[model samples]
Target: MSKKQHRGWGVGEQAEQHYLVEPRHLAGGGDVRHVSEFLRAAGWTDQSRTGGPLVFDSPARTVHVAYNPFVRPGGWTITGKANDHEPEWNVTFNPQTPVEIVAGFTDALTKSRSAHAPNPWAPLRQHGWETERAQHFTAVSPDRNAWLQFHQTGEGQAHWWAGARTEHGRTWDAVLTPSTPMHLIEAFSAALADPQPVMRPRGNIPPSRWIRTTSVSVRPSELGAWQQARISAARAATWARNSWASSSPRTHTPTPRPYAAAAGAVRTGR
Candidate 1:
Protein backbone atom coordinates (compact mmCIF):
# COMPACT_ATOMS: atom_id res chain seq x y z
CA MET A 1 0.00 0.00 0.00
CA SER A 2 1.26 3.47 -0.82
CA LYS A 3 1.96 5.58 2.28
CA LYS A 4 -0.74 8.22 2.82
CA GLN A 5 0.37 11.80 2.51
CA HIS A 6 -1.30 14.70 4.37
CA ARG A 7 -1.97 17.87 2.41
CA GLY A 8 -0.29 20.04 5.05
CA TRP A 9 1.88 18.13 7.58
CA GLY A 10 2.52 15.43 10.24
CA VAL A 11 2.31 11.58 10.26
CA GLY A 12 -0.72 10.43 8.29
CA GLU A 13 -2.30 13.76 9.17
CA GLN A 14 -4.13 15.63 6.42
CA ALA A 15 -4.55 19.33 6.69
CA GLU A 16 -7.86 20.21 8.41
CA GLN A 17 -9.43 21.77 5.33
CA HIS A 18 -13.04 21.57 6.52
CA TYR A 19 -14.35 24.76 8.10
CA LEU A 20 -15.68 24.00 11.58
CA VAL A 21 -19.06 25.74 11.77
CA GLU A 22 -19.12 25.03 15.46
CA PRO A 23 -15.52 24.41 16.32
CA ARG A 24 -13.90 22.66 19.22
CA HIS A 25 -13.38 24.29 22.65
CA LEU A 26 -11.93 27.57 21.39
CA ALA A 27 -15.08 29.70 21.73
CA GLY A 28 -13.99 32.46 24.10
CA GLY A 29 -14.69 30.54 27.33
CA GLY A 30 -18.08 31.52 28.66
CA ASP A 31 -18.91 34.13 31.29
CA VAL A 32 -16.03 34.38 33.74
CA ARG A 33 -18.51 34.47 36.60
CA HIS A 34 -19.86 31.06 35.62
CA VAL A 35 -16.81 29.40 37.17
CA SER A 36 -17.53 31.04 40.51
CA GLU A 37 -21.13 29.99 40.11
CA PHE A 38 -20.03 26.43 39.51
CA LEU A 39 -17.80 26.55 42.56
CA ARG A 40 -20.78 27.76 44.56
CA ALA A 41 -22.84 24.90 43.20
CA ALA A 42 -20.07 22.49 44.12
CA GLY A 43 -20.08 23.79 47.68
CA TRP A 44 -17.24 26.29 47.63
CA THR A 45 -17.73 29.80 48.95
CA ASP A 46 -16.78 32.91 47.00
CA GLN A 47 -14.52 34.83 49.35
CA SER A 48 -12.81 37.14 46.90
CA ARG A 49 -11.24 40.19 48.56
CA THR A 50 -11.84 43.52 46.93
CA GLY A 51 -9.04 44.49 44.46
CA GLY A 52 -7.67 40.94 44.64
CA PRO A 53 -8.00 37.86 42.50
CA LEU A 54 -11.43 36.29 42.81
CA VAL A 55 -11.37 33.90 45.77
CA PHE A 56 -13.32 30.78 46.57
CA ASP A 57 -12.97 28.92 49.84
CA SER A 58 -14.00 25.53 51.10
CA PRO A 59 -16.55 25.47 53.85
CA ALA A 60 -13.98 25.36 56.57
CA ARG A 61 -11.86 27.88 54.68
CA THR A 62 -9.16 25.28 54.14
CA VAL A 63 -9.04 25.38 50.34
CA HIS A 64 -8.96 28.55 48.26
CA VAL A 65 -9.45 29.19 44.54
CA ALA A 66 -7.75 32.36 43.33
CA TYR A 67 -8.57 33.82 39.92
CA ASN A 68 -6.88 36.89 38.51
CA PRO A 69 -7.85 38.28 35.08
CA PHE A 70 -5.11 40.93 34.83
CA VAL A 71 -2.03 38.82 34.38
CA ARG A 72 0.54 39.81 31.74
CA PRO A 73 -0.93 37.64 28.99
CA GLY A 74 -4.50 38.82 29.65
CA GLY A 75 -6.33 35.63 30.59
CA TRP A 76 -7.67 33.93 33.70
CA THR A 77 -5.31 32.38 36.24
CA ILE A 78 -7.26 30.08 38.49
CA THR A 79 -5.16 28.61 41.27
CA GLY A 80 -6.26 26.02 43.77
CA LYS A 81 -4.50 26.38 47.11
CA ALA A 82 -4.83 23.84 49.87
CA ASN A 83 -4.54 25.08 53.39
CA ASP A 84 -5.67 21.63 54.39
CA HIS A 85 -4.98 18.39 52.50
CA GLU A 86 -5.84 19.29 48.91
CA PRO A 87 -2.78 19.82 46.73
CA GLU A 88 -1.86 23.34 45.68
CA TRP A 89 -2.20 23.85 41.93
CA ASN A 90 -2.65 26.39 39.14
CA VAL A 91 -4.53 26.41 35.80
CA THR A 92 -4.59 29.04 33.05
CA PHE A 93 -6.97 29.57 30.14
CA ASN A 94 -6.47 32.10 27.39
CA PRO A 95 -9.51 34.31 26.77
CA GLN A 96 -10.39 32.53 23.55
CA THR A 97 -10.82 29.09 25.16
CA PRO A 98 -14.45 27.99 25.57
CA VAL A 99 -15.92 27.96 29.05
CA GLU A 100 -17.00 24.39 28.46
CA ILE A 101 -13.38 23.53 27.77
CA VAL A 102 -12.29 25.24 30.96
CA ALA A 103 -15.14 23.52 32.78
CA GLY A 104 -13.65 20.23 31.72
CA PHE A 105 -10.98 21.29 34.21
CA THR A 106 -13.27 22.80 36.82
CA ASP A 107 -15.83 20.02 36.57
CA ALA A 108 -13.13 17.54 37.45
CA LEU A 109 -12.51 19.50 40.61
CA THR A 110 -15.55 17.85 42.22
CA LYS A 111 -14.67 14.21 41.77
CA SER A 112 -13.32 11.83 44.47
CA ARG A 113 -10.11 10.11 43.42
CA SER A 114 -7.39 7.81 44.77
CA ALA A 115 -3.73 8.52 45.55
CA HIS A 116 -2.17 6.56 42.73
CA ALA A 117 -0.47 8.83 40.19
CA PRO A 118 -2.95 9.58 37.39
CA ASN A 119 -2.42 9.17 33.64
CA PRO A 120 -3.90 12.27 32.04
CA TRP A 121 -3.35 10.83 28.58
CA ALA A 122 -5.71 7.95 29.34
CA PRO A 123 -8.71 10.20 29.09
CA LEU A 124 -7.48 11.44 25.73
CA ARG A 125 -7.15 7.86 24.52
CA GLN A 126 -10.58 7.04 25.90
CA HIS A 127 -11.86 9.94 23.84
CA GLY A 128 -10.38 8.14 20.79
CA TRP A 129 -7.36 10.43 20.54
CA GLU A 130 -4.22 8.63 19.28
CA THR A 131 -1.12 8.65 21.46
CA GLU A 132 2.64 8.06 21.27
CA ARG A 133 5.86 8.85 23.10
CA ALA A 134 7.87 11.63 21.51
CA GLN A 135 9.59 13.52 24.39
CA HIS A 136 6.19 13.27 26.07
CA PHE A 137 3.08 11.13 26.13
CA THR A 138 1.40 13.06 23.34
CA ALA A 139 -2.18 12.60 22.13
CA VAL A 140 -3.59 14.07 18.96
CA SER A 141 -7.28 14.81 18.69
CA PRO A 142 -9.29 12.65 16.32
CA ASP A 143 -9.73 15.62 14.01
CA ARG A 144 -6.00 16.43 14.26
CA ASN A 145 -6.84 20.05 15.06
CA ALA A 146 -6.13 19.85 18.79
CA TRP A 147 -3.35 18.38 20.96
CA LEU A 148 -2.68 17.57 24.62
CA GLN A 149 0.63 16.51 26.13
CA PHE A 150 2.09 15.35 29.43
CA HIS A 151 5.59 14.62 30.71
CA GLN A 152 7.51 14.45 33.95
CA THR A 153 11.12 14.95 34.97
CA GLY A 154 12.90 12.20 36.91
CA GLU A 155 10.78 11.68 40.06
CA GLY A 156 9.51 15.20 39.70
CA GLN A 157 5.99 16.56 39.20
CA ALA A 158 4.24 16.36 35.83
CA HIS A 159 3.44 19.24 33.48
CA TRP A 160 0.51 19.50 31.02
CA TRP A 161 -0.62 21.49 28.00
CA ALA A 162 -3.71 21.53 25.73
CA GLY A 163 -4.15 23.57 22.59
CA ALA A 164 -5.97 23.80 19.28
CA ARG A 165 -4.81 25.08 15.93
CA THR A 166 -6.26 26.57 12.77
CA GLU A 167 -4.86 26.48 9.27
CA HIS A 168 -3.72 30.00 10.18
CA GLY A 169 -1.67 28.51 13.02
CA ARG A 170 -1.96 28.06 16.81
CA THR A 171 -4.82 30.01 18.38
CA TRP A 172 -5.78 29.31 22.02
CA ASP A 173 -4.21 27.06 24.65
CA ALA A 174 -4.00 26.20 28.35
CA VAL A 175 -1.23 25.33 30.78
CA LEU A 176 -1.49 23.16 33.87
CA THR A 177 1.48 23.51 36.20
CA PRO A 178 3.11 20.59 38.05
CA SER A 179 1.57 21.81 41.27
CA THR A 180 -1.82 21.10 39.66
CA PRO A 181 -3.69 18.02 40.81
CA MET A 182 -3.74 15.21 38.22
CA HIS A 183 -7.35 13.99 38.29
CA LEU A 184 -8.30 17.59 37.63
CA ILE A 185 -6.22 17.38 34.47
CA GLU A 186 -7.84 14.03 33.70
CA ALA A 187 -11.29 15.59 33.83
CA PHE A 188 -10.01 18.37 31.65
CA SER A 189 -8.67 15.84 29.18
CA ALA A 190 -12.05 14.16 29.00
CA ALA A 191 -13.72 17.49 28.34
CA LEU A 192 -11.32 18.30 25.55
CA ALA A 193 -11.91 14.90 24.03
CA ASP A 194 -15.65 15.33 23.95
CA PRO A 195 -16.89 15.32 20.36
CA GLN A 196 -19.90 17.56 20.74
CA PRO A 197 -19.88 20.55 18.40
CA VAL A 198 -20.42 23.61 20.57
CA MET A 199 -22.33 26.59 19.23
CA ARG A 200 -20.03 29.44 18.20
CA PRO A 201 -20.46 32.69 16.32
CA ARG A 202 -18.89 32.84 12.88
CA GLY A 203 -16.66 35.83 13.47
CA ASN A 204 -15.47 34.85 16.97
CA ILE A 205 -13.14 32.19 15.59
CA PRO A 206 -9.83 32.63 13.88
CA PRO A 207 -9.46 33.51 10.21
CA SER A 208 -9.63 30.02 8.84
CA ARG A 209 -9.79 29.08 5.19
CA TRP A 210 -10.13 25.37 6.01
CA ILE A 211 -13.37 25.15 8.05
CA ARG A 212 -17.09 25.40 7.22
CA THR A 213 -19.76 26.23 9.79
CA THR A 214 -23.13 24.42 9.96
CA SER A 215 -26.04 25.00 12.31
CA VAL A 216 -28.25 22.35 13.88
CA SER A 217 -31.53 22.29 12.00
CA VAL A 218 -33.21 19.63 14.06
CA ARG A 219 -32.93 17.46 17.15
CA PRO A 220 -31.81 13.83 16.73
CA SER A 221 -30.41 14.77 13.35
CA GLU A 222 -27.85 12.31 12.08
CA LEU A 223 -25.07 14.87 12.41
CA GLY A 224 -26.13 15.75 15.96
CA ALA A 225 -26.47 12.13 17.02
CA TRP A 226 -23.26 11.07 15.32
CA GLN A 227 -21.32 13.93 16.85
CA GLN A 228 -22.39 12.77 20.32
CA ALA A 229 -21.29 9.15 19.92
CA ARG A 230 -18.40 9.66 22.33
CA ILE A 231 -19.92 12.65 24.05
CA SER A 232 -22.70 10.67 25.72
CA ALA A 233 -20.23 8.07 26.92
CA ALA A 234 -19.57 8.41 30.65
CA ARG A 235 -16.19 9.37 32.18
CA ALA A 236 -16.94 9.39 35.90
CA ALA A 237 -14.18 9.43 38.52
CA THR A 238 -11.71 6.58 38.95
CA TRP A 239 -12.81 4.82 42.17
CA ALA A 240 -15.96 6.55 43.34
CA ARG A 241 -19.52 7.06 42.10
CA ASN A 242 -20.94 10.54 41.54
CA SER A 243 -21.14 12.32 44.91
CA TRP A 244 -24.43 14.14 44.52
CA ALA A 245 -27.68 14.24 42.61
CA SER A 246 -26.98 16.32 39.56
CA SER A 247 -29.22 17.48 36.77
CA SER A 248 -29.46 15.44 33.60
CA PRO A 249 -26.57 16.08 31.26
CA ARG A 250 -26.95 17.12 27.66
CA THR A 251 -23.58 15.44 27.59
CA HIS A 252 -20.64 15.01 30.04
CA THR A 253 -21.47 15.13 33.76
CA PRO A 254 -19.07 16.36 36.39
CA THR A 255 -18.01 13.84 39.03
CA PRO A 256 -19.41 14.25 42.54
CA ARG A 257 -18.00 16.42 45.30
CA PRO A 258 -18.20 13.98 48.17
CA TYR A 259 -15.70 15.94 50.25
CA ALA A 260 -17.71 19.09 50.91
CA ALA A 261 -21.17 20.48 51.54
CA ALA A 262 -23.08 23.39 49.97
CA ALA A 263 -20.83 26.45 49.47
CA GLY A 264 -22.59 28.33 52.25
CA ALA A 265 -20.15 30.69 53.93
CA VAL A 266 -18.33 29.31 56.96
CA ARG A 267 -15.69 31.09 58.99
CA THR A 268 -12.93 29.08 60.59
CA GLY A 269 -9.45 29.71 61.91
CA ARG A 270 -6.91 28.93 59.22
Candidate 2:
Protein backbone atom coordinates (compact mmCIF):
# COMPACT_ATOMS: atom_id res chain seq x y z
CA MET A 1 0.00 0.00 0.00
CA SER A 2 1.35 3.41 -1.01
CA LYS A 3 -0.28 5.19 1.91
CA LYS A 4 -0.37 4.29 5.58
CA GLN A 5 -4.14 4.62 5.91
CA HIS A 6 -6.27 2.84 3.33
CA ARG A 7 -9.48 4.04 1.60
CA GLY A 8 -12.44 2.23 3.15
CA TRP A 9 -13.65 -0.17 5.84
CA GLY A 10 -13.75 -3.97 5.91
CA VAL A 11 -12.69 -7.19 7.66
CA GLY A 12 -9.10 -8.41 7.71
CA GLU A 13 -7.77 -11.65 6.26
CA GLN A 14 -7.10 -13.88 9.26
CA ALA A 15 -4.85 -16.43 7.50
CA GLU A 16 -1.06 -16.25 7.65
CA GLN A 17 -0.55 -16.58 3.89
CA HIS A 18 -2.89 -13.73 2.99
CA TYR A 19 -1.56 -11.49 5.72
CA LEU A 20 0.22 -8.26 4.91
CA VAL A 21 1.65 -7.51 8.31
CA GLU A 22 1.47 -4.01 9.76
CA PRO A 23 1.00 -2.58 13.22
CA ARG A 24 -2.12 -4.10 14.72
CA HIS A 25 -3.02 -0.71 16.12
CA LEU A 26 -3.00 0.63 12.60
CA ALA A 27 -5.13 -2.25 11.45
CA GLY A 28 -7.83 -1.89 14.08
CA GLY A 29 -6.30 -2.10 17.56
CA GLY A 30 -3.78 -4.22 19.50
CA ASP A 31 -2.42 -5.21 22.87
CA VAL A 32 0.90 -6.34 24.33
CA ARG A 33 -0.57 -9.68 25.39
CA HIS A 34 0.78 -11.47 22.37
CA VAL A 35 4.15 -9.83 22.76
CA SER A 36 4.26 -10.94 26.38
CA GLU A 37 3.29 -14.45 25.39
CA PHE A 38 6.13 -14.60 22.89
CA LEU A 39 8.62 -13.18 25.34
CA ARG A 40 7.79 -15.86 27.90
CA ALA A 41 8.10 -18.57 25.30
CA ALA A 42 11.47 -17.04 24.39
CA GLY A 43 12.62 -17.32 28.02
CA TRP A 44 12.08 -13.84 29.41
CA THR A 45 11.31 -13.64 33.11
CA ASP A 46 7.69 -12.70 33.60
CA GLN A 47 6.88 -10.74 36.76
CA SER A 48 3.36 -9.70 35.94
CA ARG A 49 0.13 -11.05 37.41
CA THR A 50 -3.57 -10.84 36.75
CA GLY A 51 -4.83 -7.30 35.98
CA GLY A 52 -1.49 -5.62 36.31
CA PRO A 53 1.21 -4.41 33.95
CA LEU A 54 2.81 -6.94 31.65
CA VAL A 55 6.45 -7.11 32.67
CA PHE A 56 9.40 -9.23 31.54
CA ASP A 57 13.15 -9.08 31.78
CA SER A 58 15.63 -10.51 29.32
CA PRO A 59 17.29 -13.61 30.79
CA ALA A 60 20.49 -11.72 31.49
CA ARG A 61 18.58 -8.81 33.05
CA THR A 62 20.00 -6.49 30.42
CA VAL A 63 16.64 -5.67 28.87
CA HIS A 64 13.23 -4.94 30.39
CA VAL A 65 9.81 -4.86 28.74
CA ALA A 66 6.69 -3.55 30.39
CA TYR A 67 3.14 -2.98 29.27
CA ASN A 68 1.77 -0.80 31.96
CA PRO A 69 -1.90 -0.12 32.36
CA PHE A 70 -1.31 2.03 35.41
CA VAL A 71 1.21 4.63 34.32
CA ARG A 72 0.71 4.73 30.59
CA PRO A 73 -2.31 2.63 29.86
CA GLY A 74 -1.58 2.65 26.16
CA GLY A 75 2.19 2.54 26.13
CA TRP A 76 4.95 -0.01 26.44
CA THR A 77 8.23 0.53 28.28
CA ILE A 78 11.37 -1.34 27.11
CA THR A 79 14.90 -0.71 28.25
CA GLY A 80 18.35 -2.26 27.98
CA LYS A 81 20.53 -1.88 31.06
CA ALA A 82 23.70 -3.78 30.28
CA ASN A 83 25.66 -1.87 32.97
CA ASP A 84 22.97 -2.56 35.57
CA HIS A 85 22.96 1.15 36.31
CA GLU A 86 21.84 3.32 33.44
CA PRO A 87 20.04 2.16 30.34
CA GLU A 88 22.20 1.48 27.31
CA TRP A 89 19.18 1.98 25.05
CA ASN A 90 15.52 2.48 25.68
CA VAL A 91 12.52 2.10 23.38
CA THR A 92 9.10 3.18 24.60
CA PHE A 93 5.97 2.48 22.62
CA ASN A 94 3.48 5.17 23.45
CA PRO A 95 -0.19 4.56 24.14
CA GLN A 96 -2.23 3.12 21.27
CA THR A 97 0.95 1.64 19.85
CA PRO A 98 0.26 -1.71 18.26
CA VAL A 99 1.78 -4.61 20.18
CA GLU A 100 2.32 -6.50 16.94
CA ILE A 101 4.25 -3.59 15.48
CA VAL A 102 6.25 -3.40 18.65
CA ALA A 103 6.63 -7.15 18.38
CA GLY A 104 8.55 -6.55 15.19
CA PHE A 105 11.07 -4.76 17.35
CA THR A 106 11.15 -7.50 20.01
CA ASP A 107 11.17 -10.21 17.37
CA ALA A 108 14.40 -8.84 16.01
CA LEU A 109 15.63 -8.18 19.51
CA THR A 110 15.42 -11.79 20.79
CA LYS A 111 16.97 -13.29 17.68
CA SER A 112 20.69 -13.37 16.91
CA ARG A 113 22.51 -10.72 14.93
CA SER A 114 25.03 -10.47 12.10
CA ALA A 115 28.20 -8.34 11.87
CA HIS A 116 26.79 -5.49 9.76
CA ALA A 117 25.03 -2.45 11.12
CA PRO A 118 21.25 -2.14 10.81
CA ASN A 119 19.73 0.22 8.26
CA PRO A 120 16.48 1.52 9.74
CA TRP A 121 15.75 3.60 6.66
CA ALA A 122 15.83 0.83 4.07
CA PRO A 123 12.23 -0.22 4.59
CA LEU A 124 10.88 3.33 4.51
CA ARG A 125 12.89 4.24 1.46
CA GLN A 126 11.58 1.18 -0.30
CA HIS A 127 8.10 2.35 0.63
CA GLY A 128 8.88 5.70 -1.06
CA TRP A 129 9.45 7.71 2.08
CA GLU A 130 11.86 10.61 1.69
CA THR A 131 14.52 11.32 4.23
CA GLU A 132 15.42 14.72 5.71
CA ARG A 133 16.45 16.40 8.93
CA ALA A 134 14.04 18.20 11.18
CA GLN A 135 16.87 18.87 13.63
CA HIS A 136 17.31 15.10 13.36
CA PHE A 137 17.24 12.37 10.74
CA THR A 138 13.59 11.69 10.09
CA ALA A 139 11.14 10.03 7.73
CA VAL A 140 7.43 10.73 7.45
CA SER A 141 4.84 8.07 6.80
CA PRO A 142 2.75 8.14 3.64
CA ASP A 143 -0.28 9.60 5.36
CA ARG A 144 1.88 12.06 7.28
CA ASN A 145 0.46 11.03 10.65
CA ALA A 146 3.56 9.09 11.65
CA TRP A 147 7.29 9.78 11.85
CA LEU A 148 10.67 8.07 12.20
CA GLN A 149 13.27 10.31 13.78
CA PHE A 150 16.89 9.43 14.36
CA HIS A 151 16.96 11.29 17.67
CA GLN A 152 14.17 11.20 20.17
CA THR A 153 13.01 14.47 21.76
CA GLY A 154 12.49 13.06 25.23
CA GLU A 155 14.58 11.72 28.16
CA GLY A 156 17.05 9.49 26.29
CA GLN A 157 17.51 12.10 23.59
CA ALA A 158 21.30 12.55 23.70
CA HIS A 159 22.21 8.99 22.78
CA TRP A 160 22.45 7.54 19.28
CA TRP A 161 18.69 7.16 19.29
CA ALA A 162 15.79 7.04 16.86
CA GLY A 163 12.02 7.13 17.25
CA ALA A 164 8.77 6.30 15.53
CA ARG A 165 5.54 8.17 16.20
CA THR A 166 1.92 8.48 15.14
CA GLU A 167 -0.83 11.01 15.75
CA HIS A 168 -4.65 11.02 16.08
CA GLY A 169 -6.89 9.40 18.69
CA ARG A 170 -5.03 6.12 18.43
CA THR A 171 -1.60 7.73 18.50
CA TRP A 172 1.55 5.83 19.51
CA ASP A 173 5.29 6.55 19.63
CA ALA A 174 8.69 4.85 20.09
CA VAL A 175 12.12 6.10 21.14
CA LEU A 176 15.58 4.56 21.37
CA THR A 177 18.64 5.82 23.21
CA PRO A 178 22.14 6.18 21.71
CA SER A 179 23.62 3.20 23.47
CA THR A 180 20.80 1.06 22.12
CA PRO A 181 21.76 -1.67 19.68
CA MET A 182 21.59 -0.43 16.10
CA HIS A 183 20.68 -3.86 14.71
CA LEU A 184 17.70 -4.15 17.06
CA ILE A 185 16.49 -0.68 16.24
CA GLU A 186 16.80 -1.57 12.60
CA ALA A 187 14.27 -4.32 13.14
CA PHE A 188 11.92 -1.82 14.77
CA SER A 189 12.27 0.58 11.88
CA ALA A 190 11.64 -2.08 9.29
CA ALA A 191 8.50 -3.19 11.10
CA LEU A 192 7.08 0.30 11.43
CA ALA A 193 7.81 1.23 7.83
CA ASP A 194 6.63 -1.98 6.23
CA PRO A 195 4.50 -1.28 3.13
CA GLN A 196 2.34 -4.34 3.20
CA PRO A 197 -1.30 -3.74 4.08
CA VAL A 198 -2.21 -5.23 7.44
CA MET A 199 -5.71 -6.40 8.18
CA ARG A 200 -7.65 -4.08 10.43
CA PRO A 201 -11.37 -3.98 11.18
CA ARG A 202 -10.47 -0.42 10.23
CA GLY A 203 -9.95 1.67 13.30
CA ASN A 204 -8.93 5.30 12.70
CA ILE A 205 -10.09 4.94 9.10
CA PRO A 206 -13.86 5.23 9.29
CA PRO A 207 -15.78 8.47 8.73
CA SER A 208 -15.09 9.79 12.22
CA ARG A 209 -11.31 9.44 12.11
CA TRP A 210 -11.16 10.02 8.35
CA ILE A 211 -8.19 7.85 7.43
CA ARG A 212 -7.80 5.84 4.22
CA THR A 213 -7.96 2.05 4.14
CA THR A 214 -7.70 -0.79 1.63
CA SER A 215 -10.95 -2.41 0.57
CA VAL A 216 -10.85 -5.88 2.07
CA SER A 217 -12.89 -8.48 3.90
CA VAL A 218 -12.10 -11.11 6.51
CA ARG A 219 -13.47 -14.62 6.64
CA PRO A 220 -13.85 -16.49 9.90
CA SER A 221 -11.44 -19.19 8.79
CA GLU A 222 -8.78 -16.72 7.75
CA LEU A 223 -8.99 -15.01 11.10
CA GLY A 224 -8.34 -18.36 12.70
CA ALA A 225 -5.44 -18.88 10.38
CA TRP A 226 -4.02 -15.52 11.24
CA GLN A 227 -4.14 -16.22 14.94
CA GLN A 228 -2.62 -19.63 14.37
CA ALA A 229 0.22 -18.18 12.37
CA ARG A 230 0.97 -15.64 15.05
CA ILE A 231 1.06 -18.34 17.74
CA SER A 232 3.21 -20.60 15.58
CA ALA A 233 5.68 -17.84 14.87
CA ALA A 234 5.96 -17.11 18.56
CA ARG A 235 6.67 -20.75 19.35
CA ALA A 236 9.23 -21.00 16.58
CA ALA A 237 11.02 -17.92 17.85
CA THR A 238 11.08 -19.37 21.34
CA TRP A 239 12.67 -22.55 20.06
CA ALA A 240 15.22 -20.60 18.07
CA ARG A 241 16.21 -18.58 21.12
CA ASN A 242 16.56 -21.73 23.22
CA SER A 243 18.59 -23.45 20.54
CA TRP A 244 20.85 -20.45 20.24
CA ALA A 245 21.34 -20.40 23.98
CA SER A 246 22.21 -24.08 24.19
CA SER A 247 24.55 -23.92 21.19
CA SER A 248 26.39 -20.80 22.30
CA PRO A 249 30.10 -21.28 22.93
CA ARG A 250 31.18 -21.74 26.50
CA THR A 251 34.39 -20.55 28.16
CA HIS A 252 36.50 -23.22 29.80
CA THR A 253 38.71 -22.41 32.80
CA PRO A 254 42.06 -24.10 32.39
CA THR A 255 43.42 -25.82 35.47
CA PRO A 256 46.03 -23.75 37.26
CA ARG A 257 49.39 -24.69 35.75
CA PRO A 258 50.19 -27.90 37.62
CA TYR A 259 51.36 -26.65 40.98
CA ALA A 260 55.05 -26.35 40.30
CA ALA A 261 57.23 -27.91 42.97
CA ALA A 262 54.34 -28.83 45.26
CA ALA A 263 55.87 -29.06 48.76
CA GLY A 264 56.84 -32.72 49.36
CA ALA A 265 54.48 -33.84 46.53
CA VAL A 266 55.35 -36.87 44.38
CA ARG A 267 55.99 -36.02 40.68
CA THR A 268 52.77 -36.58 38.72
CA GLY A 269 52.96 -38.67 35.49
CA ARG A 270 51.47 -37.04 32.41
Which lDDT tens digits does candidate 1 get at residues 1-270? 111122223344322211223345444454555456566656667777788777777555544565666675656566776646566777787866766677677655644454567877887788789997877778998778888887666667677878888766777788888777777787788778876544433245445654434422222232333333322222333112344444423333443321121112222111
Please give the lDDT score at residue 23 for candidate 1: 45
Every model's Cα RMSD, please?
14.9, 18.4
Tell me the tens digit of each residue's lDDT in model 2 across 233-255. 65676665565555675332211
Cα lDDT, all candidates = 0.58, 0.58
Q: What TM-score number comes out for model 1?
A: 0.61
The prediction achieving the highest TM-score against the true structure is 2
Candidate 1 CA-lDDT value: 0.58
Model 1 has a clash total of: 13
| Candidate 2 positional error at 97, Å | 1.4
TM-score of each: 0.61, 0.68
